[model samples]
Target: MKPFDYLSPGDPAEAVRSVARNPAAVFLGGGTNLVDHLKLGIVAPDLVVHVADLLPATVEDLDGGGLRIGAGVSNSALAADPRVRERFPVLSQALLSGASGQLRNMATTGGNPLQRTRCAYFQDVTTPCNKREPGSGCSALGGWTRHHAILGASEHCVAVHPSDLAVALAALDARVRVLGPDGERTVPFTDLHRLPADTPERDTVLEHGDLVTAIDLPALPPARRSAYRKVRDRASYAFALVSVAAAVEVRGGVITDARVAFGGAAHVPWRARRAERVLRGAPATEESYRAAADAELADARPLEGLDGGNAFKIPLLRRTLAATLRELVGEDAR
Candidate 1:
């Protein structure tokens, strides 16, 4: 690892100031992802600004029905919170489904959103990766792409965002609060991540000196039910092959409202707006669910090769969606 200076700022202001002073500096929370990259020689920072002590260490309820999750809050603590378990079960489930218990204990809420892609090409320094080094080219394009994206992919990159919790947050319409050189600002969780267009290197919309302060989750109606389902190669300790985070409200035997987001399918937490449009006012039935799922995957462009293996994703995602909706309505009846 390269030698670097370190600064442990006491507060948000100090942390921001420290980063602003040095353009190459990066914030350190749990060091789960950043430290790994540093050891791999992917990132060579001149300074490290520690922000673990700058924010609250737990989740708090805001004045309104919303929640304020401090940036320093650990994943284990957030998943175990009673309020989260009762109100936002999807978020809790997503968090618990990610990484192992030891890694979750070391991971922080602020660092989770900022984690990098797990693309093989990006991690291997010898291979070409547009994300790690822009204009160098992407090896995964014509190389092995079994775990690559099928939606929202471009010629430059086909990497998938690896956050199950982010998919749930996108479906919930959460907002991320940040403190930067220009003061505080709020960005929609969906907008925080950017697509891999021409510039695949830029991961998020956050400015150079900005620091994530907290994540604000808006309150949903009591009747609405939500859940997150992850499908991976193995039962555990594996990244999601495809994951769905869904919230549904049913009334009069029809869908009143629906929010759906998918992970392991796109460059970001993909909000299934096409599926939501199809589900609204539609009858709650297997036929309707199939229609919605078809609509969502209409524009999907699957990777080449492995024809039979890749085709199963469509039916699997549809079944997952149907099961989630059924569970939601079933819980509502109780």
Candidate 2:
């Protein structure tokens, strides 16, 4: 890693100011993702501002029955929290399915969503990657496209976001509390990450010195039946090929409410608004679930085959969503 100046700010405001003043300064949470970038030469920040100590580390109940998860709270702690497990089981399951026990212990809730794509080209400094170095051209567009984006991807970039927690958060209608140079503000979790438009370098809407203070999960009664399903190449320490985070509430054999978010399919956690719309007011059955999946996947534009392309992800995601919804309705998903 390159030599860089380090500062442990006394307060959140000071930390924000320190990073805001310097364009090449970055906030360090648990350093799980940032540290890898440093070693791989993907990022060479002039200054590393430590904010884990300054930010809140505990999970607290909100006034409206929701939960405010601290930015510094580790993934393991959040997943193991009784309240989170009881109410928002999808969030807990997503967290546990990511990384491993040791990495989860060091990964924070704030940093998890901020982690960039696992695209091999992005990590290799030698390769031409628009996301790593804008205007350099994307190497993944025609090479090893099996893991690239199928939706919300432009010609400049086709990489997908790699955050299981963010997918769950997007499905649950969670909000992000940020402390930046402009002061504090809250943003919807779905809007936190951005699609790879012309500005593929910018992964999120957050500006410089914007520190994610906490993630607020609104009280979702239907989330009790929520679940997260990740399909990967391996059983452990692998990114998802197609993942689904879904919540469905059934009343009198009819779906009253629903939320669905897809990972490993787009530049951001894809909130399946169309699927949710199709699910609500529909009967809680496999056919309804498949129809909802089809409605959401109608926009999927898979990349042409390079070396065993990602066209399979389309049907895989459809079936995964159907299976997830079926499981939520207490039916045999097989």
Best candidate, lDDT? 2
Clashes of each: 0, 0
Checking candidate 1 for backbone clashes, the offending pairs are: none
Tens digits of per-residue lDDT for model 1, 33-100 = 99999999899999998888777787889765678999999999999998888888899999999999
The alpha-carbon root-mean-square deviation between model 2 and the true structure, to one decimal in Å, is 1.5
- Give Cα distance to truth, residue 102, candidate 1, Å: 0.6
**Candidate 1 weakest lDDT stretch, 10 residues:** 305-314
> Which one is best on TM-score?
2
TM-score of 2: 0.98
Q: Could you tell me every candidate's TM-score relative to the true structure?
A: 0.95, 0.98
Q: For candidate 1, what is the lDDT? A: 0.87
Worst 10 residues of 2 by lDDT: 325-334
